[model samples]
Target: MAETPIFPAIGAPAPDFDMPASKGRQVSLAAMRGKPFILYFYPKASTPGCTTEACDFQEALGALGSTGLPVIGVSRDSMKAIDTFATRQNLDFPLASDATGAVTEAYGVWVEKTLYGRKYMGIERATFLIDADGRVAQVWRNVKVPGHVAEVMRAASAL
Candidate 1:
């Protein structure tokens, strides 16, 4: 029900958004300036694919974390869901809830998805690599689950 992000080019400005984070704090994209950031949009917290993505990031935290970048996960789930997901998976990164789907819209991850020939609105698993200057450096849309963190880590290290 929202517009997809126009998806700024590799060197274009990363869209700025503020949403409720897993820690109950407001996270604004601008506040992340001066450091590379991983903005991954998922459909819901605790789902199979979503959980895999979060855990992969968690498992690779040593490499990605060493880069001094923030790995932020966004979803349309609520704080309750995010809390449980983080606790259950022992995820180390912050999980933000975009209940209204605004942030997902800004990032262009909210779109129609197909499952068993049924089409409905959902969050596409996607990741955005925002550089230190708040520009989009790389983007992985409609992401597959396996080895995603390795790919993202490789991209982050190159930045």
Candidate 2:
């Protein structure tokens, strides 16, 4: 019964958000100004596909970080869940908890999904590449986990 949110368009300012992140910190799009960053949304923390995507991003952290870009994973999971997932997966980047689903809604990743013929509302796997000035430079919707990080790296490196 949830209304789908309109996704931000490329070259437009990304939705600003400040959420509780793992490691006892807060991350905000505003704070990451003057540098490009990646904001990826996942359905949940510690799930199979989400885990693979997070780990892949973690593994590519060195290459991605070399571009002076920070990568953040967002989900509707609680801080405790995010913290535990990060610790268990050895994730070196930020994993933000969007418990209220507001951030996910704003990003337009909070969507309707169906599996096995049952429809439900959930966060869609999506990623936004925001440029240094806060504009969204790229977007990937319904993301497939494999080789995703590498693709993002290629686009980011070109930025």
Candidate 3:
């Protein structure tokens, strides 16, 4: 049996990441310091659940931004795929490509999953709220789409 992955605990330093993102950009933990931000991991881009989540975030972008928090979505998809998804979804926030899986693994979002009796390795639907000091403020694992963005928004505003 595979060992369960351990995630970064609240108040622990968030794992550093530098990834290629949509709109021809690079988003790094170093650059995100001094401000709280949302880093969410999804299994794939443009899928049903992922789309719902992304669109929800997009709709809440204004409120989130008002709190001085930026939202970043991460997936193991290629840059081309992520870029296309972002464009199609009209997402203003960055959709980062973690093709190498390093960032996902580091965040403990990469895990073994079973679907229809088939087992595979995939990225878990997870979110991390990192504070200005780079410490993890909150974490949501195996996230469900409904009302999730609002929940995150509330937490971010409280930060």
Candidate 4:
């Protein structure tokens, strides 16, 4: 049996990351230093759930940005796929490609999952809200799409 992954606790420093993102740019923890941000992990690009989540974030971007909390989506998909998805969704926020799974694992979103009695390893739908000091302020795991962005926005607004 695989050991359960441990997530970074609230108030802990967020794991660092540097990944290729849409619009031919790099999204990294270093670049977001001294700034609050949202890092959301999704299972795949262009999938139903992921699409809804991405689109919701896009729609809420202006409000979230107003709170000084930029959002970044991460997935194990390749850059090509991420770029295509971002373009299709008309997303202005960065959707980063973690082709190597390093960032996902570091953040503890990579885990064992079972569907219809079939077990597999996959990225869990999770989100982390990191404060300006680089500490984790909030976390959501096994996230349900409906009303999720609004919940995140509320937490960010409080920060």
Report the CA-based lDDT of candidate 3 relative to the real structure.
0.95
Off by over 4 Å in 3: none
lDDT of each: 0.86, 0.92, 0.95, 0.95
How many collisions per candidate? 1, 0, 0, 0
Q: What lDDT score is found at residue 93 in candidate 3?
A: 98
Model 4 scores worst on lDDT over the 10 consecutive residues at 1-10
Stretches of candidate 1 off by over 4 Å are 1-5
- The alpha-carbon RMSD values of the candidates against the true structure, listed in the order shown, are 1.8, 1.0, 0.6, 0.6
For residues 14-62, write the lDDT of model 2, one tens digit per residue. Answer: 9989999999989998899999999999998988999999999988889
Cα lDDT tens digits, model 3, 50-155, are: 9999999999999998999999999999999999999999999999999888999999999999999999899999999999999999999999999999999989
lDDT of 2: 0.92
Model 1 per-residue lDDT at 125: 90
Model 4: pairs clashing at backbone N, Cα or C within 3 Å: none
Q: Cα miss at 108, model 1 (Å)? A: 1.0
What TM-score fits each model? 0.93, 0.97, 0.99, 0.99
Candidate 1 residues 1-159, lDDT tens each?
Answer: 444557667888998888887766678888898999998988888779888889989888887778987899998998999988999998878898888877777777878888899889888899999998999999999899898889998899999
Name the runs in model 2 displaced over 4 angstroms. 1-4
Higher-lDDT candidate of 2 and 3: 3
Q: Which tens-of-lDDT digit does each residue in 27-111 have in candidate 4?
A: 9999999999999999999999999999999999899978888999999998999999999999999999999999999999999
